[model samples]
Target: MLALNKIRPGVNGLAVIEREVREPGPGEMLVRVHAAGVCGTDMQLYHGAGAFAQRLKLPTTLGHEMCGTVIALGPEAATPQGAGRVKVGDLVSLESHIPCWNCNACRTGRAHVCPNTRYPGIDIDGCFAQYITVPTSIAWVNPPGTAPKLAALLEPLGIAVHATLEGRGVSGQTVVVNGCGPIGLMNVAVARHFGARRVIAIDPNAKRRQMALQMGADEALDPTAAPPVQTVRDLTHGELAGVVFEYTGSPDGVRNTFAMVGALGDVRWCATPGQPMDFDFGAWRKSRPTIYNIHGRRLWDTWDVAAPLVYENHIDLQPIASHEIPLADSPRAFALILAGEAIKPLILCE
Candidate 1:
C-alpha cells in the first residue's frame, strides 16, 4: 500500500511510503482511494500554518478532500451481502471530518462546529493511503455518471455553498468575493448561479483575476492595482455589495471586507485568519452591516442546495480544476500549488 504521511513539521520528508492496510474494525468500511483534491487546508498543514498539524499525532497520512470505492465492510456492519447498498466496488465521496455524535454541538444539529471532531488526513489516518477505513456515516455515494475527478471537488464546493448561503439569499443581489483562490472562485460561480445581479472578484494575482472572470465573475479587480472597494462599489452602481464573501486570510483582505459591504447588507467570511484582526467597530456600527464568520460547510445544511447545482450543471468545476496529476506525482502537485500555479489540483489516487 502506498501512502503520504506528514512525519514532522516543516518537512514533506519521506511522506509517500509503502505500507499494509489493516482490516476494518466494527462499523468501519475499507475504501480504495480513487481521487484526492489538494486543498488550501492541506497546504496550511504542510507549512504548519494552522493548528491542524500541531494537534495531530504525527506520522499520519495526509489527505482529506477525497473520493474512493468501498472494497470491504466490517463484520458488524450492516452493509449488504453481495453488492448491497455499497458493494465491493461503489464510488463514494467522504466528508472527511466526522464529529462525535454524542457531543452537545452534534445534538443541536451543529455537527460542523463540533469541538470533538476527528478529521481524516489531519486528526487521523486519511485517504493519502491506497486504502483507508472510515465510518459509513461520513461517506456519500456518488451518482453513477458523476466524474471521479469532479466528485473530488464536492467537499470544497460544499464550503462555497455554505458560505454564500449563510447570508440572506444572493438572488438578484450584488456580490463581491474578497479573494480569487480556488474556494473564492467557486463562490463567484455559486453567487452567479444563485442569481446575484453582479459578481465582483478581487485578487492580487493577475492570472487568478482572469480566471475569476472565466469562472463567471462579472467583474475581476486586482486590488493591488486599484482599490477593490471602490471598484466593487463602482460596478454595483454606487450601491456597494449586497453580499460579500471574504475568502482571503490576509489582513488587507479582512479589513477591506468591512469596507466593501453595503450598508445593512451581510458579509460572510470563510477564511481562517492566522492572527488577530483589527476591526473598525465604529464603521461597522454606523453601516449596520451584519457579519457572518463561516467555519465548515454548514454540516448538511448547504449540501442539499449545492448538490443540485452540480447535478443540474448550474456550476461547472472543469475550469477550476486547473491540474490533474497521478498520485505518484503528488510532490510535484504540491510544488505547483505552493508556487501558486495551480487552482485546484486533483490527484488520481487509484
Candidate 2:
C-alpha cells in the first residue's frame, strides 16, 4: 500500500510512500480509505505554522477528514469502548481525535479538550492512503447509502455543529457568521437549518461570500467594506444579530463580534488564530452577551447534532468540495489550497 507521508518536520517534508498494510491490532480496525478531505489543519501541518503543528513528529500519514469502509475488525478480545459497533463492509466516518479516557478533561465531561489527544495525520498515521488503521472508538457508522464525498466532511461539520447547537438558541434569532471558509460557510448553513430567522455571512473574499449564499445564508457581506455590526443591524431592521460566530481568526472579526451581536446575545469563537488576539473587556462588559470558546466537537454530542442533519440532507456540502485529487498527487493538492483556488479538496485514495 502507498500512503501520503509527512516524512520529516516542516514544509517540503511530505511525499507519497509505499508501505505494507497493517492488520488491526487489539482495539483497532483496518479501513479502506474511500474519500478524504484536505483540511486547514492539514495545511497548517504542511507549513509547520502553529503550536498545534509543533506537537507533531515526522513520518506520519497526511489526512484526517475521511470516510471509509470497514475492511477488518480486531479479534473481539476486550475491544475499545465503541467496539462491536462496526463490522466488515460497514461504511463509517472518522473522528480524528483519540482521547485517553483517564484524563481529567475526559472524566469531567470535557473530553473534546482532552490534553492527551492522539490526532491522526499528526500524532499518528492518518487516512490519506489506500488503507489506514484507526481505533474503533473513533469510527462512526454512517447511514447506509450516504454519499462518501459528503461523508468525508462529517468530521469538520461536527465543529460547525458543536459551535452552532451547543446550548445556544438560534431558532428565530438573527445570526452572524464572521467568515466564509468551508467550515465557516458550513456554520451558516447549520444556523439556517436550525431555523435562525436571518443568517448573515461575512467574508472579504467574493467567491466565499457567494458560496455562503449558496449555502442558504440570507445575505453575504464584504467584511472590509461593510461595517458588519451596522450592516447586520440594518439587515435586521435596527436590531443586531442575536448570535455572532467568529470563524475568521482575524482581529477585526474578533473586534466586530462584540459589536455585531445584540445586547444579551451570544458570541461563539470557533476558529483559532495563529496569534493570540487582544480583546477589549469594555465592549464585552457592555454587550453582556454570553461568550463561548468553541473547542472541537463535543465528542458524541456534536455527532448527534450533525448526523441527522447530514443524513436528512439539510446541510449541503457539495458546493464547498471545490477540488478532488488522487492520493499520489496530494503535494499538488496541498499547493492548490495554498493558492486559494480550492476551499475544500477531496482526495480519492481508493
Candidate 3:
C-alpha cells in the first residue's frame, strides 16, 4: 500500500512511501481509499504543529478526510440499509476520530469533545494510503452516485455545518464569517443557503475576499486595511452582525469578533487559536453577546443533517477544492496550503 507519512518531527519531514496494511480485525472494515482531503491541521502537522509530534506514533500516515469503498468486512459486521448505507462496494466517508464511548462527554451526547479520542491519520494510520481499516461505527455511507472527490469532503463540511447550524436557525439573519479559509468559505455558502440576509466575509487575502463573494458572501472586506467591525457595521447599516462565525485563529480576528457581533447576538468562535487570545471581557459584557466555542462537528446526529445538505446540493463544496493532487505529490500540496495558495487540496489515493 502507498502511504504519505510524517516519519519524524522536523520543519519538513513528510514522505510518501509504501507500507503493508494489516487486515481488519473484529468489528473493523478494510476500505479501499478513493479520495482524501487535506486540511489546515495537516499543514500544521507538516510544519510540526499541534499534538501530532507528541501524540502521534512515529511514521504515521497523515490524512483524515477521506472517502472509500468497503473492500472487506470483518466478522460480526453487517451493513446498514437506506439511501446512504454502508455495504460492500458502498461509497463512504469516515468520521476520522472515534471517541471512547465511556467518556463523560460521550455519555452526554457530546462525543465531539471526547477527552480520549483516537483520530486516524493523527493518532493512528489514516487514509492517505491505498487501503485503511476503520471501525465500522465511524463510517457513514454516501448516497450512490455521489462523486468520490466530493464525498471525501464530508469531514470538514460537517465542521462548517456544525458551526453555522449551532444554535437557532440563521435564516434571514445578518451573519459575519471572520475568516475566508476553506472552512470559512464553506460557512459563507452555508449561511447564504440557510437564508442569511447579509453575509460578511472577513479575510486579509484579496483573493479570498473574491472567493468569498463567489461562495455567496454579500460583502467581503480585508481586516488589515479597514477595521472589520466597522466595515461590517457599515454594511449592515450600523447594525452589528446578528451572528458572527470566527474562523481565523489570529489574535486580531478574535479581538474583532467581539466588536463585529451585535448586542445580544450569538457569536460562534470556530477557529483553534494557536496561542492564547487576549480577549476583553469588558467588551463582551457590554455587548452581552452569546459566545459559543465550536470545536469539531456534533457527535450524535449532526452528520445526519449535514450529509444531506451536500447530497441535496444545498451547499456546493466543489469550488472550495482548489487543487487535486496524487498521494505521491502530497509534499508539494502541503507547500501550497502553507503558502496560502490552495484552498482545499484533495489527494487521490487510488
Candidate 2 lDDT over 1-350, as tens digits, reads: 98988777777588899977888888888999999998888888888879757877777788889999998988761364665888788899998888886789988877889989888888878899999888888888898899999899999999988888855668989899998888998999999988898899999888888899999988999978868778787787877888899888878888888788888888988878889889889878987889888888887888988988888888878988899999888788888877777879899998
Instruction: List residue ranges in candidate 1 displaced over 4 A.
Output: 78-87
Model 3, 245-325: lDDT tens digits are 988888878888888888899888788878765778888899998988788888647689788888898888898888989
Candidate 3 residue pairs in clash (backbone atoms < 3 Å): 172-195
Q: Write the residue-wise lDDT of candidate 1 on 22-83 in tens digits.
A: 68876678999888888877787888656886776778788888888889987766532122
How does model 1 fare in lDDT? 0.81
Stretches > 4 Å off in candidate 2? 76-80
* Per-model lDDT: 0.81, 0.86, 0.84
lDDT (0-100) at residue 165 of candidate 1? 79
lDDT of 3: 0.84
Kindly give the stretch of ten consecutive residues in candidate 2 with the minimal lDDT sum.
Answer: 74-83
Model 1: lowest-lDDT 10 consecutive positions:
78-87
Clashing pairs in 2: none
